[model samples]
Target chain A: MEEKPVRLDPWASAVKLEYDKLFRYFGIKPFQEVLPRVSQVFGDPLHLMRRGVIFGHRDYDKILEAYKSGERVALVTGFMPSGKFHFGHKMVADQIIYYQKLGFEIFIVIADAEAYAVRKLDRKKVIEIGLYEYVANLIALGLEKNKHTHIYFQTNYEKPYYRLIQMFSRKITMAEMEAIYGDLEPGKVVAALTQAADILHPQLEYFGGFKYVVVPVGADQDPHIRFTRDIADRFENELGLRRPASTYHRFQTGLDGNKMSSSRPDYTIFLSDPVDVAVRKLKRALTGGRATVEEQRRLGGVPENCTIYEFYVYHLLQDDRELARIYSECKEGRLLCGPDKQYAAELLAKFLEEHQRRLEKARDRVLDYVEPPEF
Target chain B: MEEKPVRLDPWASAVKLEYDKLFRYFGIKPFQEVLPRVSQVFGDPLHLMRRGVIFGHRDYDKILEAYKSGERVALVTGFMPSGKFHFGHKMVADQIIYYQKLGFEIFIVIADAEAYAVRKLDRKKVIEIGLYEYVANLIALGLEKNKHTHIYFQTNYEKPYYRLIQMFSRKITMAEMEAIYGDLEPGKVVAALTQAADILHPQLEYFGGFKYVVVPVGADQDPHIRFTRDIADRFENELGLRRPASTYHRFQTGLDGNKMSSSRPDYTIFLSDPVDVAVRKLKRALTGGRATVEEQRRLGGVPENCTIYEFYVYHLLQDDRELARIYSECKEGRLLCGPDKQYAAELLAKFLEEHQRRLEKARDRVLDYVEPPEF
Candidate 1:
């Protein structure tokens, strides 16, 4: 039987993503030149890279060349402070931390203005969430607090940044904007303009001008990346900016076997969830197990269809040998579904307990990473 | 013979403004309550008001009530800093100065962002023109150099001002923007957004919130006023801002009997022009005269159609008796067009010479009026 098609828009929760098909659809080159470079640059490929979760890129060679030339490259990945800060958001943070370890400058833009415009949230509430939830979680996730790491609120970085947004708005037409983001409202259009400004403003003359800047994003955010790259090209003569580079990563699947989303609390394991809440959520999660333990043992479980297996492969399992052992055991019927879920819940509980403790400390120092742009 | 219909839009330069029809078309009420109220408010009505040049208004009753109740009202009149600062711009400055004397707070916005976006001018060049030509000329025209008078560049005031602009963009739609400015490019849309921001930003909570604001504009700029008033109403529930009030003034007729514009250099005597240049320009101006001096003496010249006569009535002669005498002399064969042009040229030269001297002093003190907004 032919498989059903999956939807992949950014806002939907039920959209299933197929990485290889999406790479072809978006015209992104596969991340296949990873063998020698991964060893040379990272000593070993990161977990996300080794597992092919970050599957494609555009203009990434420019970033690699900048790194090889002993020149630093900047990384930008902004988040709208609208929904719950969840593990799905953590995927980008993970790559950002890896990039930070490789001596890349990191910029975290808390897109509070987008939240205000698109979500109709008040500025005060957006700012509160950006500080207490998103910034705190990002710091806990290993985003360094130094000159190389700059966090900023989109609405607050208005001086040169907003001026640049207005300038970029001139470079694009309403028809081009509609082509990229279909039938957008004025707020969404402004939000898209602001996002382009967020991506390219760091390359401005005062901010060291343009050499190479990389953005690590999920496949759904490719439109913003494409739009920014077009803007960078149009501004090539005037602003002297290089087209921005970006890597596309796969979306984290939800507990219900759909795409993870903050809008559905049951489907998302929020970064700030308490240990017991996370444990309860994992226990009730949907799995690709048989109806009976005896049948599960006989049939072996379909680990490829299991959210628990995905959590282990993507998040919790750091040891290659242990991950291989779990995979083989599930396929050979040596491991049962109940025990596997229990093990996953315990691992998540331990992680959440430690993360919550670190988040408290991170909250106190989050503001240190927020750099207000000079006038 | 039937008269030709007038064309009036913000971008055109050949519009013949029929004030009564325009007031009715733009939904502005005629200024018919000009009895004792004018003398009571302004001591004696300014020449623009006395001559019916300040002809119509919207929500102007709110401004009058605010003034009567001893509440301070604000006046905002922003100009795009793209062209020569001419006498056409001076009409708005003259009104601002009049309001300044009546204890009204004045805000003059140098719309440099709009110039950069719509005219594609560089930021540095726009800023230079804004300060040296526009702001200095306004100061020379009697805009006060006090705390009550604030002048700002739209791009430079990006922090709180741009945030307010993003907020307003959410309140409006592409359809609405198209309705106001038909089929605008993204640049012009942004310029329109920036203009609305310039109009409403002074009422932000940090800038003393909203009570009443009055914009002095020509008949053509009624679109911006109308658009901003709609935004003010849309944001009423959330921001509690009062609708902005506006008064419409007639456009100054060019020397060639067209609408005055800086793009046509021969038609405009720039504020920065030398006294000799102003005199030369007036000598070559269009006038309502017959084929010969004898025929003009017999038919009597039409002072109403003479640009030199308008220069005296609007800019040069402040004495009512002298202005009336000049008007009748040109109409009743007592004065010829050549001598009238020479007298008007001399009057303009003397005024411009003194104005240039004051402008030099104003240049050193322009920063006093440039208040960077605090969010």
Candidate 2:
């Protein structure tokens, strides 16, 4: 008899399933209580009904409170052109489009320098190739060419832009650099200074006055923002520029029951994946239940721990009631992995069709955002 | 006996006088050595024979060797605006004009920042007041407006101008900064860096290449340019700027045997001094001779070491042969200090006639140079 792939730890998968939920997994209190406050401030800007991808936040509640008191806040995000875009990044765009629709002015920095430095590219070709891929993909998503959204490269500007980056860095302590960057090599230390400079750049200058800046990133970058907050007041004084409210949002995983990454092609469906390819990847994706269909029907499956259900939670279903129904049905054996995968694939494929069509028409529209403000 | 005046030490005065003779009093080397070297690579851009108030040089021989071999070189100098013109400064204009006549692309920086930093002025009022004084003084001194003479403020500009100071600083050990700046305070490191940056600022960025630069400065700055040369190679490397030849000219002193400064109204004969005021100041000026008139006549005044004769050589008198005659006659007691003073005053008054007239008419021209370059 052929031995089945043994069901490894489901708790490990539960940890993975905890996308926006990871902040709760990690015990940060601010992220937990922020949604109601966010809703109070902007009245569900995206009409999100319930939070979808945002798992964690830091000081988000304070920002929301400030906003409800009629304070202005801006949002910040970043993209490093390391490789092709996939569904994981599409979710990032979806969240951005949502928040942006709610009225947050956004700063999206394309990390060409950091990307090139880390990836070890041929220096001569760095900007041309990488920037093209980034610009195209960003437009492919639902990002609008709005006045409030600034999409810029890290090094392509002068004046109020990187000028604050320089002045802010002048006040940063070396001890602080160590905390944000870890035990950095000399090159990494320089990179850390640049990174620290980046966090301060947009808020301190782009809008003249500081506003709330929300960073949508994973757990890896929390250390950087934490260090930024510690030094923000001092850097503001030294730079003679305004500071901003800021927060972060972490996301969860996809089909292959691991971190949502394209390293394993079957792990993520590309935003441009063919309808059939999308369907097959989702259909074959792992499930958390007994092997034989008869036995599975009798013994309830673990809905909270299933990767297939994670796709539905992160992507397909937004309604909390619908999600609860799906969750209960799966646990009761009324639903199965095959149907869940098919539903997610259909939603994602439909989303991709509109996205690909929008990508063609929005090329010039996205390029228009690159124009600098007169002042 | 009547209360004796509280007399200062003769030895202290003598020591100061001794040091100032070859160094301070005659800070710039004789133009004989300076101009031809400048003319070498510059290939005599200015048609006239190189000579004037902008006299004296250091390492001009090496510069000539390079210049004659068709290597380009640069020139550096400045004007300080002290409200009115002086014969003392008219000579500086003459010197700068002579160098420009010899094909040197001169960097005439108005010492506005130094004046503000040292003098402590209101920022809003300073630059305007300075440029008015500088432009009038320079044009009066007959600075050729175009054809390679680009005058700028010390406050504005980027080029090989200030960056070389930092670039070359790595080559300079702490021993150097301490020696020159004298236990530089922590807060003043930026000032020292500015000093270093200044040495190479003219060569910085995409500034057209220069092979040499000569600074026409007061003797006090010898320590700076000497340090500049010591680190020239390394400064070139760090800055990504070319290394240019440099010379430091010692500005001559006052008729009253003291350094020429704006505050010591009597010490420096203003170019705007009614000729009689200049003559009167020259009459009361200190002499490097015995107290008795007979003794001074017998010994001949110490012309080489005397501040009065130093001015004649550096300012009023241009012909080397005539200068040699005055020096020999004065030291031999053949020419009296009283008559020597009168001769210098008369000669300077005649030379400054047109410059004073120009200053009277050209104060408004200075403002034009204050705007941004059309890059």
**Which whole-number lDDT from 0 to 100 does residue B359 have in model 2?**
74
TM-score of 2: 0.61
Q: Model 1 over residues B1-375: C-alpha lDDT tens digits?
A: 132232211112212346656655777876545424767765877777776667777887778888888876899888888877899888878888988898887778888777777788877778877887888888888887777777887767747778777778777888888887887777877788788878887787766666579988887788888898888888787776667898877778899999789888898888888888878988999998878999888767766677887787678888867877876666667799888888888888888989999999998867777743221
Off by over 4 Å in 1: A1-17, A21-26, A208-211, A290-299, A364-375, B1-17, B32-35, B360-375
Q: Write the per-residue lDDT of candidate 2 for residues A158-204, one digit (tens) a residue.
A: 34443233233344554666665654332343344445555666555
Model 2, A45: alpha-carbon shift in Å? 5.3
Candidate 2: C-alpha lDDT: 0.57
Which tens-of-lDDT digit does each residue in A1-375 have in candidate 1? 132232211112212246656555777876655435766755777777766667778878777778888876899888888877898888888888988888888878998878887888877778888888888898898888877777888867747678777788777888898988888677887888888888988887666556579898888788888888899899888777778898877778899988788788997899888888888888888887888888877777666777887788678888767777777677667788789999999899888888889999998987787743221
Give the runs in model 2 whose Cα sits over 4 Å from its true position.
Answer: A1-29, A45-73, A81-92, A111-124, A162-240, A251-354, A360-367, A371-375, B1-322, B329-367, B372-375
The per-residue C-alpha lDDT of model 2 at residue A117 equals 45
* Per-prediction TM-score: 0.90, 0.61
CAPRI level of candidate 2: incorrect
